[model samples]
Target: MISTRLASLLFCSLVLLACSSKPNQDYDTGYDFSQLHTFSGITTASNSDPLSAQRIADAIQSSLLTQGFKQADDTAQFKVNYTFNITDKPKKSGLSIGLGTGNWGSSGGVGIGTSVGVPIGNDSAKLQTIQIDMIDIKTQQLIWRGSDNFSFDTGGEDKAQLTQQTVAKILAQFPPQESLK
Candidate 1:
């Protein structure tokens, strides 16, 4: 029975891990995260498409507001900002060749092998990196940063949805944990 319970727990753990994405995050240990409560509009966004930039900013604003943060332009505690970059992933060769020579039982043998990797999904997808930053307005220093990458297609019909999801995913790590301070 214990073995069965352990197996069940392991299955559940793997399922949870597969469903969640952990963003790359960093923060300044000297900053007190608990005191942060207000933010202004996105200080700056680097994106070729103004519409997409606006969508990202709005998504960030909505996420922060939902997390109990208020918008304060003049007396803001931290400034919210983000950047978007799209990079073409280098094409990968699907075929691989290998050769090996071995001696066993005082006999030598030569072996050659080749393997092909057939992509089951789109291999030409471009990756976009979205980085969100929380900067101290007075010090002009970055206190926290979170970044993540997702497959992006310029002409995709779900650009708005993808932009919002990417921003939310990256900003989900904002404010840092009090333990980090």
Candidate 2:
């Protein structure tokens, strides 16, 4: 019985973790990304989850380094920045718990218990819109921009993995492929 309850909870958690990766990209076609090497972070994000934003920046830096880019303390060849907003969404689900009890009194009594959660004001989920930008150090203007809109249970499992995957997805559109243009 406990196993069944645990399984149900796991399934619900997985359902809540579904992320829709809606990505939108804009960049300066005139600027050549191949000429850029060093990368530094400059952020103006004031979201509730500053740590998530920091994780995102770290993931981005890691991804760029893997692609042969260098990290600079200052005066980088290019700069990276990001902003995020978490919007409260309407509740799509309710919590449920079940309890059962029986008394051995000549087949006398049985009891059942259940609980359901009701959404209060501003007690729904959160949807985050994240935007990542790249700027030329010399030009000091926007050179590339990538944004993604995704939703997941902020308190659920695998948060670090989620952030890493989200950042990786956003950066996959960066450096703007010639075929994409």
Candidate 3:
């Protein structure tokens, strides 16, 4: 009987896991530039997750290279940098209700409460924003900038996959207008 119960529980767990949805890919990659050449190295502002920062930077660099931008040496046609910020908010799990009368009739009552499972205070880690900027190396003026704000669950393997996908999607917006069909 115990084994049967355990098997049932395991089946339910796997079903729930399978039913869970993957993170939605939401990003905006709007740029005004028509054409561009080799891109220089990328720089990142101080980030809580240095590994994440590097991963993002590398992903963008690789995407740029695939787009025909040669990694430059002495000078770059454009320079890039990114900033990431994370925020947390408390989450509530259940609801609360008051029940009248205790066993002693001492005017005391039993209060039942349950959490809503929704963030109530700064409790859940959320990726607030990911901002990337590109500048004209010669003029040192801002050429392109993109910022995306989205919520994500952290410290999971899915987070890393999402990051890579987000970076790639964002960089895909570079060089702006696409070739006419």
Number of the top lDDT candidate: 1
TM-score of 2: 0.65
lDDT of each: 0.77, 0.73, 0.64
Q: Candidate 2, overall lDDT? A: 0.73
Sort by TM-score, best first: what order?
A: 1, 2, 3
Give the per-residue lDDT digits (tens) of candidate 1, residues 67-155: 89999998999998888777887445578765555567966665668898776566666777778889988898999999887666564
Whose TM-score is greatest here?
Answer: 1
Please tell me which model should have the higher lDDT, number 1 or number 2: 1
Task: Specify the poorest-scoring 10-residue window by lDDT in model 2.
Answer: 101-110
Clashing pairs in 1: none
* Inter-residue clash pairs, candidate 2: none
Query: For residues 39-58, could you state the per-residue lDDT of candidate 2 as single tens digits?
Result: 87656557568777777777
| Regions of model 2 farther than 4 Å from truth | 1-20, 91-123, 179-181
Superposed Cα RMSD, model 1: 8.9
TM-score of each: 0.70, 0.65, 0.58
All candidates: CA RMSD (Å):
8.9, 9.4, 12.5
Q: What is the TM-score of candidate 3? A: 0.58
